[model samples]
Target: MPSGHANAGYRRLFDRSGLTFGAGFPLTGTNRSTPDPEAEIELAKHAESVGFDGLWARDVPTYWPKFGDAGQTFDTWPWLSHVAAHTDEIALGTSSVVLPLRHPLHVAKSAATVDRLSDGRLVLGVASGDRDPEYPAFDVDPDSRGELFRESVEALRTVWREDYPELEDRWGRLEGDLDVVPNPTEETIPLLPTGNSRQSDEWIAEHGDGWLFYHLPESTLESYIRQWREATADKPFAIAIRVELADDPAAGPEPLHLGFRAGVEWYRDYFRRLEGYGLDHAIVGLQNDDRERAFETFAAEIIERV
Candidate 1:
């Protein structure tokens, strides 16, 4: 496939319909429990069956004592690898991997491996480190993550694109005959940026394949997206919603940090507004206290509705 200009995966979610929706991890750490992929696989298959555009996995390197939620409680890559084989068509993604914490070369290698195994259906999202506790444990400075993230993205691009791609960055060197084998199906894989990561608008506009924005009201979503367009002026914009769906359509809106609790009707209406706002994608974060019930209800209700 020709890379960098336009491709099927990018065009499907980022171009056509102007609305790409995907389910975040159905499990977000409740009830002293962790997500079981075997159990989750049934739900994933259901999602694919129901026509969700994609499924996103997250990387939580540590469970912080201060942080109440435990996330999906699995290393992201292994989970993605397992599910990629189990399902047939749904695309796989990472809401984000903390790039500053890992070597970019390793990330390139792993991403390429998953993309190859899945037959070129990997969309990698990356970000600077957020958990303050994690930075020290890895002997990396949280304050300097923005710089590291830029370096990491650049390094990964080099390794993915050219054989022993020449390096001229603050990160390091890839001197002689080194190369990352099995370059992505496209000349490169899509690298979606999460948040600002301390990058200037120019840097983001120039480098980011797509942009991820967190929690915005319908109107706010419109304004932010407009601003992103004005800033980047040429790139695609993707947004994420932290959603908790209730069984009843009239359950009303309750507050979560970056999301809300609403019923299926409201969910549909709200998403429609986002589509009108020119939002390209909405990655829904499902944070149901009841795991099995949440997945089942969403599949029957919203996923089926979409």
Candidate 2:
């Protein structure tokens, strides 16, 4: 199914079948404090060169010690812009920007700027924020995040798509007088609401260009896809999974974090099953001690072969 957006990056990633692959950023391995910038860029280039369709960046506003994940340890805007400068064709995406923590105008403006600069390569994944401490630090009420998230989505769409949209929401009021300049490359930026954002499935289906979800069991994933199809037609569905590719081609599945440890053959079959179940894309986090070798093995085995 084709994505609603006509942008090349969007089309290349979402408007395909048979499980298009994407690499998650920082492209560095887990439990790392800071990513090596030069190596990360090289890896990003490698990912694009190897026929990966997209690269995903996460939004972690303030790193919480308790949260235990630094999330690329770079601000999303500048990070994406830097990545855009380095790569040519791969789509750039936010794993999710925490909407309630940021004003919609800023989110809209920054996103539009990246979209234009990247030549329409941005796909925004928005969330209602999960970290409890971040809410107080940002001066947002955790209980009200769901409402703020909905309002922010509305505001972002209005500012991007309408020339002088009149909006009177909690974010602020625009009287149809001033406009947010440097509008997106497309009429509307593709928005994929991540994990419901505290809204109903019907709401996400109606509002989002697609759905971005975490890894789920096969049966559960199929059920979710079936429900999504019932809610809307043609919108894409994407999932992110953490994978550790085993050396032996015939190695079977073993449990890992949010994904599994398996051989190329097992993954090939697993992804084919996902494709059969109507999945549009899979964003993979390669977990290995050797990053470059892991990427090469994945490309040679799963990506190129699958």
Each model's TM-score, in the order given? 0.89, 0.97
Estimate, for each residue in 73-116, the C-alpha lDDT of model 1 and write its tens digit: 77777788888888876778887889988888888888888887
Among the numbered candidates, top TM-score falls to: 2
Worst 10 residues of 2 by lDDT: 28-37
Local lDDT at 53 for model 2: 92
- At residue 114, what lDDT does model 2 achieve? 94
Worst 10 residues of 1 by lDDT: 1-10
lDDT of 2 by residue, 218-239 (tens): 9999999988988887999999
CA deviation > 4 Å runs, candidate 2: 30-32
Candidate 2 matches the true fold with a TM-score of 0.97
Residue pairs in clash, model 1: none
